[model samples]
Target: MNENKLKSLTEALTELASAERYEAELILKADPDTVIAQTVAAVRRSFALDIEKLLTEMGFLDPTTPEKCRQSAEAGT
Candidate 1:
């Protein structure tokens, strides 16, 4: 990824991690398996895209070969 997009995504990841941590705490208190599962699912959706493909497309992760490129593409970097 470019510098700007990388920064933005990094910030977003931090925020998302914080939100998930809060939700986990709440889940602990509520003791509801469904709620906990749902909360986790929500967090997963926030970063649902492939990471390697995203990294490659964004130019964050550099691939060494065609195979690596395909892998990253499939991974959504």
Candidate 2:
């Protein structure tokens, strides 16, 4: 990805991860087996998937060659 797009994606993913972590912390205080806790966990996992999908859509992730994609992302290509 280009520099601008990478920056935007980084910002968005950071914000999303932060918000979800806060929410999970609050909900997880009750009990691990609780419905809310389970829901929060599911949401967290989904957020990761969403991030991956977003990256792929933005041309940052290549499912067929993940190592190359990781290298490109790390190198900020």
Candidate 3:
């Protein structure tokens, strides 16, 4: 995904993590298992891109190996 889309997804995830209980309850009324699995997959994918963007913006990631990129971010944090 592009940086803008990645940032949008990350922001959505942050909002979902803090969603109101009533909204969460309504969402849970659906197929929770499938929803959770899909959410996890999306999160994992978005997390990688977000982390890469964050590291690059912070002048840490080499824009080559993502593993090294994450390590650099963590080291500073």
Error of 1 at 21 (Å): 1.3
Choose 1 or 3, whichever is better by TM-score.
Answer: 1
The global C-alpha lDDT for each of the candidates, from Candidate 1 onward, is: 0.67, 0.78, 0.63
lDDT of candidate 1 over 1-77, digit per residue (tens): 36889797687657656866776788778967667767777656654444444556666667555587679999999
Q: What total of clashing residue pairs does each candidate reach?
A: 12, 0, 0
Runs with alpha carbons beyond 4 Å of true place in candidate 2: 32-41, 62-77
The lDDT, on a scale of 0 to 1, for candidate 1 is 0.67
* After superposition, candidate 3 runs with Cα above 4 Å error: 1-30, 66-77
Write down the worst ten-residue block by lDDT for model 2: 32-41
Score residue 21 of candidate 1 by CA lDDT: 73
**Model 1 stretches with alpha carbons more than 4 Å out:** 32-77
C-alpha TM-score for every candidate = 0.44, 0.55, 0.42
Highest lDDT against the true fold, candidate: 2
Instruction: Give candidate 2's error at residue 38 in angstroms.
Output: 3.5
| Arranged by TM-score, best first | 2, 1, 3
* lDDT over C-alpha atoms for residue 10 of model 1: 80
